[model samples]
Target: MVNLLPIIKQTLLITFFVMSMMLIIEYLNVFTKGLWSKGIEKSKWKQVLLGAFLGVTPGCLGAYTAVSLFIHDIIGNGALVATMIATSGDEAFMMFTLFPEKAILLNVVIFTIAIAAGWLTDRFFKKKFYIPASDKHFHVHEIPECTGFPKNTFWHQLKHITPTRALMLMSILFFVTFITLDEHLASGSFHGILKWGHSSHSDSDPLWIKITFFTVISLSTAVIFIVNDHFLEKHLWGHIIKRHFSKIFLWTFFTLLLIALLMKHFDLHSVIQHNMFWVLVAAVLIGIIPESGPHLIFVMLFASGNLPLSILLASSIVQDGHGSLPLLAESRRSFIIVKLLNMAVGFSIGLAGLALGI
Candidate 1:
């Protein structure tokens, strides 16, 4: 139990950041009336650019939104390809937590590649890969009430809060309080509070990360306070929490625990060093799994200096997380095409990077 304490703390930190990010994105999407999704149907270039932009965002929400647009025929196949190509699924959240600078650079590269690949895909396969007529029309549930704020005062809403709103508000407040306490204890800013069963630890995140978490959590607290039941229930709790929370938490916890155990038990770094080429291949192959949880191993490996940038990039390029699962269901042909293109791009980049010893 004592040995697991650090891993548990790290897992919670990562999960909090990931959840906060998703909440902010959901709020923006609803508040903007899905504005970022509009005008995307006007041009192929626009579709590709918008797709890449959304894909680079740190969660599967963007991919889901893009898939919704694609199935509706609002965006073309190329746009879907770009979105999947650029998206790293939920692993992106972990990447941001573990190696933010490299994660940023990786996303930029994925964005660029996604744009070019999307453009070329449309140019060549425009006729080859059309949205099947059956899947061409589907409905995305939209809460009309979520499009704008209610006219009621914040205090009034709080006074009349529903179960969902109350739960979200209390949860956000608890997280905020916990984060503040952790920061203070880690920094020894309030040493007198140590007797409260909390340790003054040295595992504090970097200053920028601390600031980022504080700022985002504060914004989230405000969001919880302001959003009406419709938005809180339908978007935040219903979508973000229900769909994402458990998966992110479990993946992070188990991945951290497995890594910890492996390091403790064996010479894992040496094994990886001896089979770097095979490891890169495995990374690209694992990227095909479609789920975000599998690729996290590569992200963690890269963060710990046991894996190369090439392998991480390759895995990222090939995997769309669970983002493509809907596409698989809606249109198997389109899903296959996207995966084929992704594998090609991922493998080429992996080999090139290896040959150049990057």
Candidate 2:
């Protein structure tokens, strides 16, 4: 139990952070669906650029948003490909938490690649997708209304609080407390697993991360006003939160625990040293999982200095940042085709890294 403490802390840190990130992103998606839909009615290149930019944003929100746009026919498959190729998935959150400098630099590279890939795919493979018509009355894109007796007043908003608003507030509180407490526990390291690389007790994330979290919190709090009860009940909280948070959290916990146990019992460093190529292979293969939890192991390994940035880049490229879930849900053919494009790009970049010693 004593030894497991670090790993437990690590897992909890990841779980809560992931949830918080999703909340913020989901809030933005719900709140800005109107603006997004309206704004994206422009050029395809603009859509691709927008998609790549969002994809490089840490956490699953950007990718998920892109997926939503694609599914709604607001964006083409090229933009979808761009988002997937650029997105590093949920692992980007942890990377930014531990190594902001490297994460940002890497994401820049990813954004460039995503833009190019998206453009090429759009230019060459342009084809109309037959999104099977849905008869369901669950309208996700309808503009929300502040349907109540009073309008935009604090009292009215407070009185008409939905379960989702309450939950977001609680999560905001939890994150604030968690960051402060975890920082104290780890002596500024904040997270035990974050201590893996650069091995410095004094190390912590950059100021931008703290700033971003606070910004997201404020934005999340404000979302209660912009998004109405129906969207919260029927879509944002009802669908995304219920569907994604638990699954991502549990999978992250177990995967970290398994890695913790493996670290306790065996020599992971030695095994990797002996089988570096095979390990890279496994990393790329695991990127195909479509879920974000398993990839944390690779992030941890990279942070521990056991893996290269290039391999991480490969995994990030190959991984669709959970944007594919909707695509997978809607049409497996589109999902597979997009993933195939991502894999090709990921491997090319990854091998180039190995070859060039990047």
Candidate 3:
């Protein structure tokens, strides 16, 4: 029972970030009237590059951004694939700590592969995966509520906050408070709750992560404050929270918990210790998981000289941390396709590297 606490904390953190990104994107689309969407729609390669760049940014934040962008139709299947390929999830941080020089090289290779793979996916498989804007099957709920600023003053709106508004405010505040307290605790006894290797960043949380968290939370809070009753009830609460919250939370929690159980009950370490062939296979298979912690085994093994770069590369290429959980909620088909594509790429490159004795 006690073993599950850290998993809960991790799930909460992932859920909060995913929800915040969704809200932020929703706010941007409403306010900017899809200006950002229009820009990305012009060129496929442009979207692919943006996705790779975001994917390479440390942690799962960039992957979350890419998923949000894809859901809003600001990007396509190719770009999402690119983001997943380039992203090593939280394992990238561990890699940097374990083997800085090799980590740099590995990331560079993955980035290049991500770009190529993304461009190829768009060129060959675009039509098969393209979800038209009018496709209701893949559409996010669109409430016909007024999205303009409330006629009432901010204070007036605050005073008359409805249940939905109150709920949203409390949820965001709780997430913020949890993050603050977690960081403080992480610096002391709970330092490794979120990490396996020593972090390269000076702070408990990365600087850019702090910046992104605060910026998005601020925007979301401001939106909650000024949006009218209809928008709050229909769009923010109904569409964003009701449609997404439980799915993301449940999927993330169960998936992480299942992986934790597997690692605990199964003697995977000894299995990997025996054969290079099985290790390569295991690396690819585990990389299929949508969580982060499992991939760190490869990182640790590589750092300890017990695993080769080829296996680690394959694992990194296929696994994308908790970044893909939102996509899982949005469209299971898309998530499967992305993972299959990544697996193919990871295995091909992994085998090639092994052949060359990398």
Candidate 4:
């Protein structure tokens, strides 16, 4: 327990800092909203540029939410691809926390490449393939109520950013950490428990072992969340977390943590080292997953190793996930087709880059 204190403290501190930065950005809204609104009205090139900029940061859900907010109005269609491609997901912070030097540079490179490719694709292929039906046109007669700048004062903002919200956020972090720790702890605990049971009962089929193991894992996770919630409310941390439950921050953090755990457990580094070509192939074939977090996780894994730069660059071009699917679902068949073409072209470009050693 004593050993866990430092890790807990570090996690809490990182979470607080990230939240504070997001709050500051929200308060400013000038950069985010202004750039978005201004860029959307311009050519596809400008929209792609804006998308790339949005993607450089790790807020995949926030980006989508922003897109959804603007979908009815000011934004263009191709911008979605650009934004989705460029985002690194919130998990970059976890990389920074664990492996700062490599993760930072790798993320920067990935973001830059994704943005540039997305912008270019949007510029050349605007509305060429995927066109919405007449009833499903992309226009904004009136800006949605949620589409405007935030209207909170400095004091109001400060008042809302309390320790309770911080605590809630911390509780969420703790839950994630607990799962990782529990995985480690259970390996030993289970071995001992099974050994003890073996002496008492022979010929016990291990048929139920897999089922019970998973059940215990699921139950343990639920218990952690419940306990964290209860404890937070009973303490000052609860108020802080509650006060600052910004969806963007929460989602971003969750995404980042997921990526970190994936990398930690999956031996992604070794996979990248051996099958670098196939990894990039997967990127080109699948393009971006709908969610930025999942997409970027693959990107980061590829980037962290000696994968060919061309493959890396090419993989970044295909924007998948959040940007394409929702639009396809909205009867924008032309847009969907255009997105697929863009992805194909992006993949080709990556392949060409690899072939040319450019």
Number of the top TM-score candidate: 1
Across residues 14-83, which tens digit of lDDT does each residue of candidate 3 receive?
6666666566556554554433334777788889988897777666656877777787677887899999
Model 4 agreement with the true structure over 13-94: per-residue lDDT tens digits: 3454444333333323322444345435646666666666665554333354435533544455556655655544444433
Give the per-residue lDDT digits (tens) of candidate 2, residues 61-160. 6776676677667789788889988887777876775566788888999999999999999888878353657744222223333233234555655787
What tens-digit string does per-residue lDDT give for candidate 1 at 103-130?
A: 8989999999999999988998766354
Compared to the true structure, candidate 1 yields what TM-score? Answer: 0.87
TM-score of every candidate relative to the true structure: 0.87, 0.78, 0.55, 0.50
Q: How far is candidate 3 from the true structure (C-alpha RMSD, Å)?
A: 7.4
The lDDT of each candidate is 0.77, 0.70, 0.72, 0.46
When sorted by lDDT, best at the front, the candidate numbers are 1, 3, 2, 4
Worst 10 residues of 4 by lDDT: 189-198
Which residue runs of candidate 2 sit more than 4 Å off their true CA positions?
A: 34-42, 57-74, 126-151, 159-186, 196-198, 201-241
- Which segments of model 4 are wrong by more than 4 Å? 1-36, 39-44, 65-78, 91-163, 166-271, 285-288, 292-325, 331-335, 338-342, 345-358
The prediction achieving the highest lDDT against the true structure is: 1
Candidate with the larger lDDT of 1 and 2: 1
**Model 4: residue 330 alpha-carbon error in angstroms:** 2.4
Candidate 2 minimal-lDDT segment of 10 residues: 137-146
* Alpha-carbon shift of residue 48 in model 2 (angstroms): 2.3
